[model samples]
Target: MSTGSGAPSAPAPNSHHDTVSDDATATASARGTTPGIAAGPAAPPRKGTFSSLRIRNYRLFATGQMVSNTGTWMQRIAQDWLVLSLTGSSAAVGITTALQFLPMLLFGLYGGVIADRFPKRKLLLLTQSAMGLTGLTLAGLTLSGQVEVWHVYLVALLLGLATVVDNPARQAFVSEMVGQDDLRNAVSLNSANFQSARLIGPAVAGVLITAFGSGWAFLFNGLSFIAPLTGLLMMRTAELHKVDRVPRSKGQLREGLRYVSQRPDLIWPIVLVGFIGTFGFNFPIWLTAFVYHVFHQGAGTYALFNGLMAAGSLIGALLAARRAGSRLRLLVGAAMLFGALEITAALAPSFWLFAALLAPIGMVGLTINVTANSSVQMATDPLMRGRVMSLFMMVFMGGTPLGAPVVGWVTDAFGARIGFLAGGVISLTAAGLIGLVLARVGGLRLKIDLRRGHQHLTFVPRAPGAAAPSGEKALAPAA
Candidate 1:
């Protein structure tokens, strides 16, 4: 079942949410209609990293995402392999990737607007179904020997369009399932779930493509949509926490942008991730180049590199799931480590050492992703979450299309090592610059205390005349 009130309004900027368990629970209690929110009524939620699974709705959602994510990963690998086989040019694979992410760059904001206007549950159902069909169609074409580069390109673009809507709605819907109490845990688990699929999906695709053909892999991907569809159908709608849907209106796109611009915390992290996503995360191109040209190895070595990275990523996500908080410091710290590791790996002398570095790099990269995602979602208003998250997804993912061609050119011209090193330099520089900017805006100054057992470093209050971060209050110095 779907839930939405007509002409819903957003919460005020300074509105108090502490009184409510979260936006959904607050809405439910206010209406006194929805059930399954109170602890007494439901079974005690599971503890630690898997706590979010305690909610029946979330449990079903996670199960579906797990299966669907694996299929999605399979399709990603198979699609690229199919395109490369047909065209025999690495450029063709890049084009396929660009086409898939291009929609997010172009129209992702409007997709968020639509998500805010409709029921997230229903939107997900539609998008998930559409994705499934696209997979099936591609499978049919491949199995029939009718597949072409153009056909793959077109399907990639269609899938990207579906993702533009799916990403934001799917992100915002987590809060609806578990409320704020479990939102952080759920977000971390979602990352873990994807990474776990990353481990399974690519390996499975490699086998399927080699054994039966890429067509069979596509067929499995096409069929994988069943899990998510079934999960959505099985969900008990009444138990879902409510979120106010924004009614259709003009300037919503601008409204979302403006809202983000005014919030320093939101905008800075988004900016930091955007830089990391665009320049630092071009792994497919970089890793492949390293495997063939630098390491003088074949597909097997590349697969090993990817598998180690996925293992690290899985570790990072699970660790994040255990923690209840998301901090900007964690986000900044993880990004720095990620950038530094990339630079180190790029310059490594031995293949074994380089391969070993991949795991830590993947771990830190996942930390950056999961931290940014959870922090952004936790900070945004429930009413504006869809739009805010849309922007987050846009900058984090959509930048790839724009960045990939440039990164590809650099790799082609200067060699893979230089390209990888340059990406790390940019990422590290951006994190440092953004960290300073955040401190300046927040009216915070660094204070170093060298006393034993005391904090070695921290942010201290700025001088009395210093401006506050927002129009709100600032930290005053202790008398």
Candidate 2:
């Protein structure tokens, strides 16, 4: 089933070759292959957020990711717990996290070049195997009572190195599995899968750590790699929709940087994401502080908060799946809402009220995530997808190394409430500034009108020969 550019070219068509199914006929007609057949009506497109699940390859990929994501979250919780148990220092925990993401900031661009030159599937196999080994090594060290802070640090750095490559390859690999037709649905479903795992993994990790120890959680994560590795092996190669591989060449990394720099749509969202990611997405630091300092609670309460957020995130992902397209306005609005909600949660007087607000915070946060991811992917050229997505991931995830320490310092110096307030203020400010920039760059004119006792805001393109608005001009639309 696998067809590549290396495959022998098909023979020229002859009069005798006429076998074709009705579906094939319809496809050919749609493509203008047969002028007579093109006269007929076209078939309807499939609908639903789960439409991507109908693809065998995507089904396998999602199924595997669900299991792997669970283990990933479990290890995340256990790692933090173990570090805290050993040192009782939040700053130590921040350093550990910063180490895990430091490689992405330093080497993520080079990883994109590798992804563009190589086959993603093959590259993933190697990276995933390396990560699994790191997990097993950590598990062994923990179980033997020989795990030192240095050992954890070393393993975290190693895992981050593997992730530098794996993240980009995996992000760009979705196109090959389901093609553009189902890409948005696939991305939303992937988010849902991760969020669902979030709901289960931390809760399970909490139980394991309470009963057996943190060692068991790490051990389980080590074994969880089996599912994804198996799924990769079983995919039908021929069915994959292969994209053109960029030839090995000099300056490719710089070329990617130049490409993104010129495109306002790509760069602006990326900038917003960088700010929000650096400031707003420090959930580990924030959540841990809330549980230990504000609520005076244990690991169980911490797990419950995460579980509630994950539940909200899952719902948001599903709602995103039902939508057909991504919009820049939606991303900006969601970012603003997410920030506002976080501020509200920070000021909540009661524990249950704070927990209640977390659901909406999770919802808006996922909405922004899904919208930005899909919009960027849909806008980029196929040849540049790997590099562009790598840049996006680098900005989104790499910022953690820079921001976590600052947030942790703020928490330690001030209180956890001040930390939340700082994050919210940064998030809201980013959204507002980015919104105005996008409006100006896109030549969009905003109007306010009163209807049914409510004020409505709308954006419209300027008309030709009309008096120009102060800040409006013709500009390219974001794809």
Candidate 3:
């Protein structure tokens, strides 16, 4: 929707190491010191929600990504329509989606390692170029009337391979561009950029598909890569804030795994994401099925639903940008709300009513995504950012391969409504369980208070040695 490797030798917990300068910078930033900047009088308050745009590199990156992300979404819509046109089967669509994400499930961890070991800008140049070429090849094949489902499958796999590297590099690179102080805002704005592109891309793809054919949409997407490539080339390398490159080590992957294992703040969110992503995030499959089978609609109607959802997502992202930090409570509440709305939408009797529900559904979904992403990035060590983010993405996006096919099959066999219901149930259950786990493990107790004739439930930290609940330690703040 758009929404690891084999076991190695275990490394000692908390034994992860990094360059002294990088470690010092991270520590200073945690203490409110601007890393690499001379101390001076208090800076003026940031002006607006888009404060991260003040940085030259991030501005360039965001502008380029806006264009590229639109193209990416265009291709996504075109590809799905093409598969449906070729096979007329929802299960085929699911298989295609699964193949696209299979590499992430297999080698995403290795991609994180690569991101950590190399210059992020250099790696991004290579990956982005490779993705562009893949897009062009697909456009040519489709235009020449030689395209087949297998061709689509092959191209999707290639793109997925590129993304395995691109995703982690892009995520970790944000720290270098804006430093820690604005990371949450930067991450939120990135989501806003993506969703805004989503608002434009699918609608355009729908028109292109209906007016000409899927080939033109693919061709447009192929050419759209130029914007990101140009932006990357134009970035001033000297102005970039550089993090330390991780040195080669035998047990580094194991070390990343061990590090994540020990942090409840990190692990629980990842686990919750894994559940929701696997079951809840199959929008392409579910939405397409609902449009074609349930509503008896065409390409325009499918695009409309997506556009509406993106509109909500954009609003949610902008709201997140106005905030200074991420919290577990926000993540949990958003997930539950997203799941509940999805369930309600699934039961809608009319297409218009169903479409109306998608807006709020998109809003809560984006809220969960931004909160989870920012919290993880902010709480992680700089040296471990790539590996940690790779793991987070692996759980979030990689679960698609495992879930899409099954969800597609369920939709085909049962109905689109049941498929949606299944996803919502899984998401709701995951949020409830994870929330309770976090509360118990973090020494938080839920207290119900009556005020102004209203009852409220609040989680408050308990007193020391006050019979703390037996569980893992609460997630430590970013080190």
For residue 3, give model 3's deviation from the true position in Å: 18
Misplaced by over 4 Å in model 1 are 1-11, 14-47, 86-89, 447-457, 463-479
State candidate 3's TM-score. Answer: 0.89
Top lDDT model: 3
372-457, model 2: which lDDT tens digit per residue? Answer: 88877766777887888889989988998999889988987898888988999999999988988877665555668878776597
TM-score of each prediction: 0.86, 0.88, 0.89
Tell how far residue 474 is off in model 2, in angstroms. 9.9
Clashing residue pairs in all predictions, respectively, total 0, 2, 0
lDDT, candidates in the order shown: 0.78, 0.79, 0.82
Question: What does the lDDT read for residue 186 in candidate 3?
Answer: 83
What shift in Å separates residue 78 of candidate 2 from its native position after superposition? 0.9
Candidate order (TM-score): 3, 2, 1
Q: Give the higher-TM-score candidate: 1 or 2.
A: 2
Off by over 4 Å in 2: 1-46, 453-455, 462-479
